[model samples]
Target: MSKPRKPKGRPVSGWLILDKPVDFGSTEAVSKIKWLFNAQKAGHAGTLDPLASGMLPIALGDATKTVPYVMDGRKIYEFTVTWGEERSTDDLEGEVTQSSDARPTEEAIRALLPSYTGVISQVPPQFSAIKIAGERAYDLARDGETVEIPSREVEIFRLTLLKCEADRAWFEVECGKGTYVRSLARDFGRELGCYGHISELRRSFVAPFAEDTMVPLAELAALEKIEDRDERLAALDAFLIDTGEALSGLPHIAITEDQAHRLRMGNPILLRGRNAPVSEADAFATAGGKLVAIGEIGEGEFRPRRVFT
Candidate 1:
């Protein structure tokens, strides 16, 4: 018998970059979109907390296969550090755990911003999603269990102090994957001999995805609720990054057809082509108008990294 045709008006493979409104988690946004489109498969580039807003990329269709590449890319965030207060979660949601009578000076904050522009060790907050003892760290913390989260080395490629007052400062940060803005603020406060916590946060960019391309959740929701099919398609296009586009984001490399075929076979795609591959995880590998996969340089050859799954 002939294969049954798929349902008409089904959503094609794409990404949806939603400007997550405050109080909405990234997963919640994905769930809503999945229901709205009746998608069979979906995922997101990164997880955003309910307190944060901006640039949450939801992957749809086969593009969900590329979500890991986007998730591992560098991220940029704009945030405000409010001094004279320390919260249990290192953000606004938690109760005040500490405070200082002293306030931070604009000059002091300006001077310290440069120190964070490079590599640094950050300890994930106790109230985080990290798992410990078979339960989430946050759950353990909520149960009043004392936990010691090990410090992790995370890179802050760029940290710019935008504005500063007596007790508060706005900042722009470009960091590697897994770095937490709240942790940075908490540590900054410690460095200055005062307390600090994140009061506001907006992720402006995640590597290739930027705020300009982000659609507000409210707007997307309104369109979806109204059954505006055309508008929803536009939203998907706005967020989805095809393989070719994603490959261009990384350093370009060319490979022979045999290598390309091998890459598709899930081999350890190595680094070899026009340019030497960057020693970063999730580096792009491509050639001749197609994406091979993202991989690292090995003994010799662009080893198959992430198959075009």
Candidate 2:
């Protein structure tokens, strides 16, 4: 067996934003990346179905700890919806359960989008990963078992109909975590009196990051062809939180090197500013103004939860 050639692409750490290619699940993309860098720990913030593609931020090494922060951020997707037919999965990947001839007007679609905005209740599809009892809901759904999926509240901060055509519409959605665009498409069709499903989906932004920061698949793939020894390490810290403004907002607590050591040893050094509130989640905890560890909000005190070296 011949040895595989080494890659020449930059050694990436911290974070890498990819324009995820279609036909690959989010896990598959992360797996490929892990192989590329030989990275032991890494994770992706959002889960994109095999049929969908777009900005997927991957965290590397210690950056994996920040995955929860990224996942909790807002997501924006531009999706195309067909107004005539609906599918069981509420997307193009699913089987068409119904077909109708009712066409929707642009004006009507615009009016419907506003109603979905803000906080509203929604029911997840039966064919979803949500667990019911001890079995996965989607598993039961595929097995032809009747599943009682309940509706829950979700916030759609923005859902705008960007453009429309006969029996079709394109929309840009900015929603909070846990929102299912497929469910929205289903609801959209139901309201228009015509069943429909999502035909296309693309995530463009993830609050702090956007498509502009994404590296194109075509380019990343081309780099794979080059020799490995030529690649330079890409510093991962570039993806860290905007620390300047956050630091300024923090109560300026100055501490000496001796105090810094004590803080790292699980000691609570007094915050210099009296009665000053520490940030809810301060990535860097300062004692006497020296960065100690990550801090958490506690009852009238900031506690060092986890320290990132």
- Top candidate on TM-score is 2
Runs of candidate 1 with Cα error greater than 4 angstroms are 1-11, 225-239, 251-309
In model 1, the number of clashes is: 10
Worst 10 residues of 2 by lDDT: 237-246
Model 1: what TM-score?
0.80
Kindly give the stretch of ten consecutive residues in candidate 1 with the minimal lDDT sum.
Answer: 239-248
Model 2 accuracy (lDDT, Cα): 0.73
Displacement of the residue 139 alpha carbon in candidate 1, Å: 1.9
Give TM per candidate. 0.80, 0.82
